[model samples]
Target: MSSVEIKVKRLNSKDAQFKQTLLSSLSLPMADDEAIDLAVLKILAEVKAKGDEAVLSFTKQFDRLGVSTVAELEISSKELEQAYQGLSAEQKNALDIAAQRVRSYHERQKIEAGCHSWEYQESDGTRLGQKVTALDRVGIYVPGGKAAYPSSVLMNAIPAKVAGVSEVIMVVPTPDGARNSLVLAAAYLSGVDRVFTIGGAQAVGALAYGTKTIPSVDKIVGPGNAYVAAAKRRVFGTVGIDMIAGPSEILVLCDGASNPDWVAMDLFSQAEHDELAQSILLCPDAQFIEKVQASINRLLPEMPRKKVIEASLANRALLIQVQDMEEACEIANAIAAEHLEICAAEPRKWAELIRHAGAIFIGNYTSEALGDYCAGPNHVLPTARTARFSSPLGVYDFIKRSSMIEVSEAGAQTLGAVASTLAHGEGLQAHARAAEMRLKK
Candidate 1:
């Protein structure tokens, strides 16, 4: 424990005002969204109307790349290979391992999730089923403003490749023409077909609307700044987006048995993402909560991103004392955190009660950081309670399902009248006639 208090909010579930307080605290401030959206709208419109010329102009303005044409922005295939070959032995091995693991997991997910075309024949000679096909191409926007994320390239591109997408296009801003070698190496490893040195709403617009150099993609994945999020939201209909992700979040539901230091670091894992990120702890053990707080104070000062972690903790972090393990699970469901860690004596037992988290980490050793990197599961999870309805980014996002129907003469004779009646009842003569025409004369 340090002499300085961390000033993270403390709450007790037994209090009458606890739920209200917790819900209020969960709402991250959204003061700048309107401003960001307005700016993104202009960028999207410009890209839609002007295409490559607009992309080049915006790239010049934002990234400070004075390239005369959009073609100059595309990172060559040879450059990608060079990026991979130039890595140190350890870095190359790590990238290979992570890439292999991600590929294996997604390949398994493809098979296990039944991402295939299937049909069933009925006794009436009618066949009905679903046909699954991969998206032709996709664009992944890896945020390049704050930091370089080689992992994002692996996570986003690997799944699309596993799903058999024909092409994977990546766009990352190279501010002042500074490119991250690791990101390029990961892109090469993950089979990204195209890399463009561009970012923000302009990059999103270029991908969605299709500039002369950047072909239009069927969907866009990966994370970005506020402008990117707003741009994705605006162009959602034109191209599919993974999700409008919010800040990183981790909720650790721990029992007294787990080490307080381990638990504290787990919270820090998410808090270090940025000041807006949220780290929460739900524990029935009040004494353990105090121990964790002490550990946080002791270890926080040593973190490289100490200031970020401190602000995140002070802004949105929570150390809630629950009545028991059961209550903690209940609250965990309510929160639907992006990452949930059940660090308890019987982790699976507690995990069974969790239904809404984007991802669940069991046991004290299962840190969220592993999921963010080498862990097979895609770290691009739902956030801000979006996990309640949405799912983590996966191969399924890159595949489309089409309903297959082969109606036999006899089957159509029996079904056409039902359809005609319903269509007529809904006041549509054309629809009714279309169905009636299919009936046996």
Candidate 2:
């Protein structure tokens, strides 16, 4: 489609209603999908009640694979090894490099980032600290059927392994009983303990509430379609989960210096993920924006996934005009974009101003795609403005901390009176008495 015909909803920050318009356009109505929720709730409820039977039943119904026993669905270590061994030399080398990089990053995160125990003793002889512990088992959900992302397996499973999680269970849908060897190879490289050929809400439910065959996991992490997102939300209280990811997004802030083709391709990179994925550009120079648009139109027909890119650009993508790079950074923080690219003359100068973003891709050479595959940082990131509150998955996500408090006699004597006073003020005589009992007579 032509740039004019694309209708990507271009806006200028100079407009009075710009803020309202931008946020309104940026909104994703994921919560409004009641049909998805209803289906997810039923699947979750069935799995909770019927266990493995429900999982197998849904597997056959959704994936068109009829399996009588859940045992038949389980993929063994021998198979994972075969999948790895069966890869071509080039494929194995790519997996090896990505796995090592991801592993090294998480290992550093564990050692340098306070993943161990620490204690401090106060003057009053009261010891207070934190005891860090990793989860016993975790599940990594890798999306299957449509596409296979071996990168996702490394990103999700390696961190759990680094954090000392005992087992990393994996569930990937094998539609029509057709499994992706690359995904299985990735699972092998990442040290995932088990693999189950299942998908959708049923897989999530099985992970959250252990079935007769599949043991329950402490946490679940990875990305999936709409139904999978809903299942994770529903089973959150039962099992910890990575953030609820929205459609992929990348915001490129340019200073009118970078090549228009590069900027256009960067936008297309995210747009090609799906029609809902968003790609935006914030530039002070209107001419640069026009160049990027022209590049987009010229390059559109060349993309294999051009149809998906067109819908994404037409629906969610934005080509915005900002006052300057400073204003661009300000708006970037406001949007809290999942992937923020400061493709400016001095990228760091603008990136330093960004307060909220899942991950910042700095300079013209640093593209969001690099972060997805081999970058040290986890690709499973916060989305839909969640960067303002949450964070990317890491070694930290696989570990939990318990508060340690040991009050000495002297500390308890002093603390008791304060506690007693507050407890009595709150009309809890039992609480006051309990504190009073701890005081030295």
Candidate 3:
């Protein structure tokens, strides 16, 4: 184990410079590159022009897999079934349980938060309301270059399926002609309509613009690397995207009562994700903060990804000393973290004070890791302070709402005068005339 002492910033909420320091530290470095954007734009245009041939070329060049036709990149149903059957019993059981939990949670979200068609008739017989309908098709981009994410497959696909989407096409990169069986099994379990072994900007382009083999989708959802993010941003108007997610983050509000080791490990969780991931602990007890620091120093060496965690901690991690739980909640709201953990004696009490966060884990026992996988809540959450206005991926993200309006002849007579007056005031003669045309003579 490496004996290097990790250097993390320490701050006190009472200090005059605390706010400024916190804000500066929380700011994420811009990951975009002009060269990457230009490359992505070129790839998108090429795919748009040459269709399947261009996609095949990029697949061979980037993923190092030479396939004669784009159709060959598509994974067959038999292969998906075989992948599922081949998993060890424990792995199969875990996947089945996680899928079931996720499906159940999304099914509930559909009932409660899902859109509905409702209309109310006015006294004059006019009816107006909204009609909610799921997108016909969607594409999910699952990352596969560095790690296989079966959980992501379940998270992105199941919600669309629950939202009543007709077709769910998934794209996962298979580097060097290697495919992850667990990811395929997840697609099978989540009821993905199609699976393509393609990724990067080219896959996103194919999904955004239909090729001969792959169909265009109404929206694209999922997470990927920097190039994929740039591609998604480039194709926003052509198709809807989930969000441009930043690095993962976690903010813990502790009352200095929980085990120091547990809190230390919790901080390590997000830090281990990557070098840019952020982890911060807010507690009133300075002694407890020191203990947690020592715990971090002692336990971090045990982590296999210690170098990553060390870099993340050194760059972005913090051990904050707040005045009390109330101050901690105020700070948490300002940060608007992706994951917020209230580890205290009265976690719910402090949780009630939190106004903004992507997801909240209450009490010492509820770790952020649980919510990431089997906690029945979506792991696809808003990041980079976007949670201040946005929310986690849910059934609502997969559906669209259309206004429903039916004007009765008598109703038009009653409403036309108001609309005509407004339209004429706005100098819109066409609008006024259209409203007048609907009125009775």
Candidate 4:
């Protein structure tokens, strides 16, 4: 098969202002697949109306699995045991190692109950305080695609478990009546309460709205395709959801010291994820840029998904030559890449300079892929420049804190006048009267 070719051209320094223009202009040429959207929506509505019957029909229609009832949708312990027993020793060992690292990293995020009180002499006999508590139950969605991501299952499930959430539910897609054994094993090992074989917007909708079979959950967390994102958006008010993720992306800030081959291979790490993935390089040395571009071309053919990488690079990839490292950092902060790789001489110093990014990989050895699989940092990251405001999935995502303010009778009297004055300024007579009544009591 003839592979797609990308021509690399040297950028002229005369167009310095155009550097930002070119960098900002780079984006994936993803034409929306509206047909898929319409089909998914119709299936989702049908599932909501027909419930389990509709789910079964779509399973057979889209997944070619003749699962006609909700009973079949549920994976039994025997099946899970069989899946675990079926894995090779090597695969089992790899999963064990990955889970250990992920669990250890998230264990540190656990929270403890907190309380505070204040007392003051106020001519009133009233007291008040606030309390915070964990949600009763939580849901996690793991995407079942070309390959099952055991890593994702760990990332989503472990945090909720640590957050003291009572129940943790996980849902994954199984195409053609097949589910990845590794994925099943991951859920089993992660202490997941229940694992259902459903996916896409319907799975999200079912979790959000609750069907006769699947119980509704307080929050849903995980990563999925565009349809899943849209479903999560629709269900936001009814239930809480993790951020809507975007395509994979990486920004490498390198100088002349980095190896061009290592850099090229690092770019491929995210490009393999999706055709829309973006890989960018910002360096002061023009010659280094050419070398890395050459390395990319040389390494492209070796990749199994070279066609996807080619298309990704042709559209979203960029080589930005800036005036210096400071300029590079400024540009990087503006983009707020999901994965920021700093390959400068003193990378620790440069890495500290970065203010906005989902995760940062410093030095040549700390490749972005390490964090994706086993570095213990959550791989379910914020994408589409959301790093500027949002954050990676962690224990904080699962827990909610209520302001705990308690006042003794004296404290109420001291605070009453201030509260009443503020409420009166806001033009709410009832609010001012409420505080005055407390004072009188």
Candidate 5:
């Protein structure tokens, strides 16, 4: 089948203007200092000083549905047992299946120690190898305000566990002190050692600085709101953070044979995420483009999240009939979408041609939704075109590496003069003399 085709149609200036406006609207949300920042600072200071008392106080002040003590923060086996009872039989089954798939996929990212040996004689012998090690602790922030995402719990926690982090802690916000049974279940199953019933910048501060109630973590990972992102930004130097993630995005590249219904639904999946979420379709078929637009108009109203989808479509959705697959790939790479679905016949072939994307979904049935939930891939991905430079959360994110070197007396003596010469060239008398002394001995 031919791979190139050019479709020319007048660009919608209004649509173009809308895309520009939406892209510019990527600003982080406003946080009042008196309301949020000061509160966060006080909580941070209190946690730093008093520890558990501060955490419990903030929990009561903010998440005042029922939790009154730190003990309430811990999820018990009884909670997990009841979680299955609350879920419909189908929902429970889906969670079980998704957990297995996600776990299985991430297990492949585990690494082992290896040795490299080499002998060189300058005046001595030397050997060098590199070793990788996991961190002592990691903190994961799960969004629990707008909705419950058990999948996120699995995606963030599984990687750290696989990386062999000594301790894994999770922080979640409960607006009215309501915990999602499924999320708690996922946490329990994922080997999370401790779960804190706190969130926002304060939660980040507690994790970064270490509180009496919550132990300080080495690195923090997960997706969150703009305030959460800004807080992560604020606390970056004190503690390591994964990324300052932006809104969710998806770009689908399709051929003339692509199904309009499928495209429409795929776009809806990202659109429903948030008003700022972007869903784009780039293809060469004018008919297919028009059909997908019509399908969006038809199916959007029928969905319960029509208002959110409508806002997202009006603000961030796009339908560009590009010149060809080559042009489509160029535009997709430029956008660097969090999710890229290639619905072309040779999806794998086309996927290889692309260079920038957080995750690539292939073929018609391989929709972005699968990656979001049960696909066994990390859903916490880079957004706002950062995928060009960033990668999805994985076992690698939780580990650190150090280079090892061993110099034999013979190797050091053989190489000493060269090292001394370079050190002397840099005008470092101490360094040169140190190597020279070793050589002399």
Candidate 6:
């Protein structure tokens, strides 16, 4: 397609209607559909009632794999080892490098941000602090069929392992009884305790509520289809879940000095993820924007997934002319993009201006793709402006904390009077009496 023929929206940041237009365009269809919710509810109820039988039935219906019992679904350790051994040397090497980098990064995160118990004593001899502990078990759901994401296994499983989770159970669908060896290898490498060949909302239900075979998990992490997302939302209180992610998104803030083609491909990298994925470029130079547009047109046809990229670029992509890099940064903060790239002469200078982003790719050499794979940061990120409130999946997600309080006689004397006064004021006589009884006569 010609550069002019591409339908990507072009807007100037100074336009009067720019804010409204941008908001409308950036809006995602995240609202739950009634049909999907109903379907998920039914599946969850069935799985909860029937347990392993329901899981097996759904696997057969959805994945077209007939198995009389759920025991047939569990992948053995020997099978995992054989999968690892079956990989080509190049694939094995790539998986090893990615796993090592991901593990190292998460281990650092565990030391810095993962839970740790701490306590301190006051003058009145009252001790107060937090007791941090990792979740006993976690379930990770990896998408299969359309594509096999070994990276998803590493990203979700490694963090839980680093946080000292005792068991990490993984569930992936195997349509037509086809298993992706690379995914199994990744599971083996990441030390996942169990692998189950079940998927969809049924798999999520099995994870949330324990079955005869599949043990219940403390939390479920990883991406899935719309049904999986809905199931996660429904089962949230029953079991913790990572954020409900939307489509992948990337916002590029270029200083006009970087190569236009490089910037074009970076935008394409995210757009190729799906038709709903968004890719935007904010630059001060109109000429550079045009050059990038030209490069996009020139290079887009060469992409293997050209149709999906074209649809994404035409429907969701944008090239906005900003007044300057400062204005671009302001716009980026408002967008709160999943992936932000500052491709400029001094990327760090602009990076300081960025306040909200799932991950920031700095400098010309740092493509968002690198961060997606071997750049030592979790690729599972917040989407649809969720970075404003949420964060990328990390070691912290697998841990919990409990408050610890110990009060001595002197401390109780001081605290009981205040507690009694407040409780009585609130008309809770039982609470007032309980606190007063703790006080010395």
Best by TM-score: 1
Kindly give the number of clashing pairs for every candidate: 0, 0, 0, 3, 10, 0
lDDT of 1 by residue, 40-159 (tens): 999999999999999999999989997899999999999999999999999999999999999999999999998999999988999999999999999999988878999999999999
**Model 3: per-residue Cα lDDT over 153-249, one tens digit each:** 9999999999999999999999998999999999999999999999999999999999999999999999888789889999999999999878899
Q: Kindly indicate the candidate among 4 and 5 with the higher lDDT.
A: 4
In order of appearance, the predictions have TM-scores of 0.97, 0.96, 0.97, 0.90, 0.87, 0.96
Candidate 6: where are CA atoms >4 Å away? 1-5, 29-32
Give the poorly placed runs of model 5, Cα more than 4 Å off. 1-54, 66-68, 81-89, 111-125
Q: Per-residue lDDT for 281-301 in model 4, tens only?
A: 888998998889888878899
Clashing pairs in 3: none
**How accurate locally is residue 81 in candidate 4, as Cα lDDT from 0 to 100?**
68
Question: Please, what are the lDDT tens digits per residue for candidate 2 over residues 203-322?
Answer: 999999999999999999999988999899999989899888789999999999999999999999999988899999999999999899889888888888989999999999999999
TM-score of 1: 0.97
Question: lDDT at 374 for candidate 1?
Answer: 94
Off by over 4 Å in 3: 1-4
325-376 per-residue lDDT for model 5 (tens digits): 8878877887888999999988887887899999999999899998988989
Cα-lDDT of candidate 1: 0.93
RMSD of each: 1.4, 1.8, 1.5, 3.4, 5.6, 1.8
